[model samples]
Every structure is written in structure tokens, then in C-alpha cells.
Target: MELVEKIKKSSVTAFISRIPKLHLAAVAGLGAILLSTQLLSNNKTPERQRTTISLPVTVSSPSIAPTIAESAPQTNSAAQWRTEKLKIRNGDTLSSLFKRAGLNDRKMMNFLAATDDKASFNKLLPGKTLEFSLNKEGDIEQLSYVLSKLERYTFSKDNERYSLEKELREPDIRIAARTGIINSSLYLAGTDAGMDDKLIMELAEIYGWDIDFALDIRKGDSFRILYEEHFLDGEKLRNGPILSAEFINQGQVFSAVRYVHTDGRSQYYTPEGKSMQKAFLRAPVDFRRISSNFNPRRLHPVTKTVKPHRGIDYAAKTGTPVWSSGDGKVIKSGYSKYNGNYVVIQHGGGVQTKYLHLHKRKVKTGQRVRQKQVIGTVGATGRVTGPHLHYEFLLNGAHRNPRTIVQKLPKAESISTKIIDDFHRQTQPLVVQLEAETATLLALNSKGSQNKAL
Candidate 1:
């Protein structure tokens, strides 16, 4: 109580009482206005705060406002680009893909104009992907088209103009080995051993010159291969070329190793550096069965009279394709009462091949065709009882059995002497691997047989 009475009676209170009440009220009002102004400035809109400048401008005669360029806020040049990805679908075009990605036609046209070569883009296949990078204003800054696992196209903006660039990625290659025994067919055994159709076909082709897979394959035939498998980012992309292979057909063992010469040509060769390819294929078509063999005194199916069946008859589906036995020029591609839709090819060394009773002919007279090229499809035409191919081989105007004659013909050329040492060095390891794998398979088969006998 004593402290309060002393403060009330102090000289500071007497001094304040002598001042005017209007002056005190004016001071208090001024303080309130200053606080309100600070709160309003702190809560200003983003647009107003971004455009606010410290500089003050005066308009002459109060008739002109600031120009848009001078008053607008500058955009951030270092903004991160936004990305969107889209996949190609059937019946999808470049314009449609761009529109689906929220891009305009003008931008797409600009990109196309910048691309010098647009062949890959023109043939846009399904399952490919296109990616776009956009700026803050939704304008394309960068674009990428992934055509396949190996090839890609990129379009980037440089100095306000777009430029296209191509990129290619090489897959990592690793050696792979597989072994299989044939119980019914090579195709079936290959599938059981986890081989794709493409790889199986390639395997057949590698040994086709010596073993006519269409006819020479037996129940106990087996094969071992040491090949390449391509991978990218730890995932297998596809299978590469065969490095080395060993095939046993009808109790005869054949081996081949792939080698690439210094001149960039690649082919399969034997351990002693001999080529694995022959001048001609033994069988021209994949036949199911042999309807008739080469018989001089055979009863014709249609006439029931003794006639010389010069060519071998192959039973197959009507549309089964017939391939040229070797590289040759078509001598005749015509239809006759005896030979329906036949094609005759004249090869080197006085050798000629005749394909009779075809449903459709693919080659014309005088057209040069390579070995294994489809010339026609099998059909039952003139002088035939059913859908079968009558294939004939001629040597110097005399008919010969295709199956037996092809085996006796001259072998393919051997590797050149200059690259023999290089070939041996590169292929020796692959041959060793193939042999090891084959030995392991043989051991397993022997063990299984022994267990069954016991």
C-alpha cells in the first residue's frame, strides 16, 4: 500500500497531467496506423511481391503506364524440366502420339523439320516409347524416342532450335552352353532344352550343309553348342551367334567353330580350318515323308503302267515353300501339262535343279536367286496323285538322286592360309568348351542307362 501511494504522488504523473489530451490521442493513433501498414505489406500477394521493384518511375503528364516488358517478372532460367513418357500403339502416328502427350502440332512439326533423316520415325512400330521434357510454360525442352533395346533418338533444344541425335547401345555378350538329345525331332528336343525357335533354326542351319536335318536326323542323334547370349543392364536381351557346335547325326560326329577374319568376314569352320558350308543344300524343302524314290521301272500312280520316276517325291503340305538348292539363275519358270508350276535353276559346274508341282512360283526366268531362297510352294499339279514335291537334280543333262548326289559333291572352300593361325587361336577355347559340355552330357546319359539296367 505504501509503494502504490508513493508512485501515484510522483513528479512524472504531475508532468503528464500538464500535457494536452488531444496531443496524446494523436500520438497513439499514429502508432496504430504504422502497425497496420506493416501487417498489410507482409501479407501481400505473390504476383505483387514478385513484380515489386525498389526503383520509382514518374509518368509525364500522368498519361503513360509502364510497358508490359518493363513491369513483368522475369522467369527462372534454371528451372528443372518435367518429363512425360508414352508408348506407341497400333495405328498410332507421330501427330497422334504428340497430341496424346499434351503437345501441339506446331512443336511436332518443328521437331520433324529439325530431323534430317526421319525414316526410323516414319516406320514407328508398336511397343516403342517416346519421352518428352517440358519447361515451366509446358513447351518441349527435350524429346527422346526409344526405337529398340539398342537404338534411340534424342532431340534437344539448343539456342532456341531443336537438333536430332542418334544413340546406339552395345549389349554385353557372354558365352552360353546347351546340350540336347533327339527322341522325336530336333525342333522338339531343342524346345525341351529351353532353346527358342530362332536359336534352333540357327543350330540346324549351322549343321545343315552336312546333316540334312529334314531327313538325316535319327532317334539317337544329339548336339552340343557353346554360343553367345546378349545382355543389357543385367537382363538377357537375345541370343547372339553360335561360337562352336558339335552335332552327331546317324552315328557320324561333325564339329564346327565360328571365326571372324581380320577382314571382317565371319563364318563357321572345322577345327582344322575347313569351311562348314557346302556348295549346295542336300534337301531343298522340309518334307514329311518320301512318297517315291528314284526308280527306273516303277508303276505310275495315274497311268498304272511302267514309267521311270527320275526325281524323288517329297510329301508335304500344299503351301510348304521350296528353296533353291544353290545360288543360280532361273532357267525356266513355267507351267506345263506334265510339270505344273515348275521352276528350273541353272547353277555353276553344269548343275541344275528342278522343282515340280508347285502351287505358286516366286521366281521368274533369268532372275538370279541365292541358295535357300524360296522359289515356289509345294502343290499337286500335272501327273501327281496328291500334294507332294517332285524334286530333280541334273548334272550335265543327266538326272541324279538329289539326296545321294549332294553328299558326294565338292565341299566348300577352306579358310585362307593368311588367317589360319588367327582362326585357330580364337576358336580353340570354344571347341574345348563344347567338347567338355558334350562329355558331361555323355556321362549323364551313361549313368541313367546304367541305373535303368540295374
Candidate 2:
């Protein structure tokens, strides 16, 4: 009894000395632990015994860590640069664009140059988008141009401030395409699927010579592309070189690849080196919608007679622009009772194109016109319906289906001497990862088949 009283008195002093500031629950837990340890030392107190298990220390958990997670005061923004995009509307110039982007300076003049300054600003096309990334200081860190696809220019900074540097933003093209089905034009489907309009344009240009994009496209047609894709900062920015493409129209699948020979002249090819782009495009204009079909015996909606419709009619708003079929010389630009204000283009290799019922003729006789150049406008000037353009394509002076023109992509040159070294250096890591993942997938696939067999 005297020993127990002396032990209790010593424990009171120890608790007062070290454990007064401890939490109630912690103090109770610690007292129990110590009391159990003491009792464990005594075989006479077996029921009160306890075993202590120590925790392994971790990197984040110190021996004397505080019991709570504390967060620091946050003041700075997380983003160093924020990307922004704006589409060019009519009457928008680079100066206005710069102003809108909060860069009210003469810096754009340094970039546009005097040689093409006025032309660049005045020749604004609608739906063209320009992208820019703004740094924390509100200065433009980078500019992305989407003329066809994205081109980026980065700003360099030394001890002083930032300065823009022109950098070639290549397509980072991968020969690739995806099959899509649409009731209308491939243009509609491509843009709908977030496919870059520039890529769609390139695809059309490549196959312009063979496929008549207007009359040949049908519902349930699927297309595939093996084309170049672009990337910036490991994120896909736009399109690059189109290595190959396949478009299905009216149950026909058309395919082409970029082919470069030993001499360095490149062209779009079939599995064979057949040109996808011919001397002429299958049709002169990408008509908005087909208003009339070629029929041997059908009543004219306007003429009210059972007449042979030799050509196709495309519907568009009045003054909706028309384009030339191919690079050609204007053979005739005149008005006739049957043809109205019409223009005829005589192409190379005995091919010919005709456009009738124009609102106004853009080219005069003997003037040269390139493919996609403005030829005229849609008008009800001829012996036809409301606002529509009558278009015709003749090969050796005979009618062929306009949609059969094969599109040939421009050949992509080998990684050139200038960019090849840099491209390899930049893309090596991604290539390695992609290759490794592909190998892993192959191995797993093989293993799965073996398991299935068993």
C-alpha cells in the first residue's frame, strides 16, 4: 500500500511536468498506454497489459508533424499565358485585330512590312481565324495563323523584355484521314466533325481534278484520310502534310498518296503515280446545292417544255460567286438568248468548261483564269429558273460525270535539310512513347488471342 501511494505520487509529478498541455483525448490515450506498459511489466497484472506498435516514418510525415493540414496564402495566377482565338469578319484588318487583342502599338507594321501592308489588311476574308497567346504581362507571347492551318511565332525575352520571333508552325502532318458519312458535301461533314477547313480545302484541291464534288457525293458515302496532322505543345493544333486520302462517293472509293521521286518533284499519286489533279477540275464551281439534274427528257421548270437538259444547275443566292474550273484561257464571255451572260473556258489537253446565267462576268475574253478564281455570279439571267448557275464540264468536248474527278494532294517533301534535324529532336520523345505503346498493345493482343485459343 505504501509503495502504491509512492508510485501514484511520482506519476502525478510526471504528468504535471510533461502532459498538462496535451489534448484531453491524447492525454487519456497516452496515460492508458503508459499504464498498460507498466502493468505489462508485472506478470501479476496480465489483464491490463498492452503492446505498442511503431509507425514507419514517411517522407512527408515527420516525427513531430503538426496534426492539421495548413494551406499557404495564394496570390499569383497559375497561367503564364492564355490562348485566345478570333475569327476574321468582313472589314476587319490586322490593325483592328491588334487593337481588339489589346495590342495598340505599331508592332504589327514591323511584321506586315510595307511590301504587302495595304493588300494584307484590305483583302480580308471572312471566317479566317487568328490565334494569340497572351503572357502575364499582357504582351503577346505567341501568334497562331490559320490561313490554311496554324503557324506560330514565339516571343523571346532576355534580361529586358519580350520580342516576337517568327517560327514556322508546320502541319506536324501525319498522313491520315477518317471515314465520314454525310448527306451533303464532304466540306460540311469535315467541318462538322471539327476537321480543319484548311485540311478540307487541301483534300478538295488534291482530288479536284478527278471528283466532281457537286453531283457525285451521296448519302452513306464514307471517306478515309491518311494525312498529316499538326500539333503544338503536344496538343494537336491543326493539320500537316496529307500522306494519303480516300474518299467514297456514290459507291466509288477514291484514294491517293503523296509520292516524291529521286529528282524531288512531288505529286499526288494513286497506288500507281496517276495524277489526282488533272489539267482541269471536274466542275468549275463548288455549287451551294444542286438545283437541277442532267436529264435527257424532262420538262423545263421555266420553259414549260419537255426538253433535253444537257447541263446541271446549281442553286445559290443572287450574286453568290462562281469559280473557274481550272487554269484556262477565257474563250468567250458574252450574252446569248439561250445562255445569257455566260463564260467559256478552254482548258489544256482538249478539256473545256462552261458557266451560264451569270449575274456579271468577271473575266473578259482572252483573260487567264486559275482554278477557284472568281468567274461570275449566280443569276436568273438565262432561260432558267430563279437564282441558279448552269455549269458544264466537257472532256474532249464530251460530257463526263462531274463527280468523277480524282483529287490529288500535293506531294509532301522529305523532312528538309533545314527542319529535319529540329523535327527529329522535338518529336523523338513522342515517337518513342508511341512506338512503345504500340509494341505493348501488339504483345497484349497476341497474349489475348492465345488465351482465347486455349
Residue-pair clashes per candidate:
0, 27
lDDT of 1 by residue, 213-294 (tens): 6667789898889888999999999999888988988888899999987778888888999888888987788666778777
TM-score of 2: 0.53
Candidate 1 overall Cα lDDT vs. reference?
0.85
After superposition, candidate 2 runs with Cα above 4 Å error: 1-177, 182-196, 260-266, 336-338, 349-351, 393-454
Task: For candidate 2, write residues 118-233 as lDDT tens digits.
Answer: 34245556887777677776755556545544443344433334455455555444433344567677888877645687877777877776666677667777665555666655
Give Cα-based local distance difference scores for all models. 0.85, 0.67
* Model 1 misplaced stretches (Cα beyond 4 Å): 1-108, 116-143, 440-454
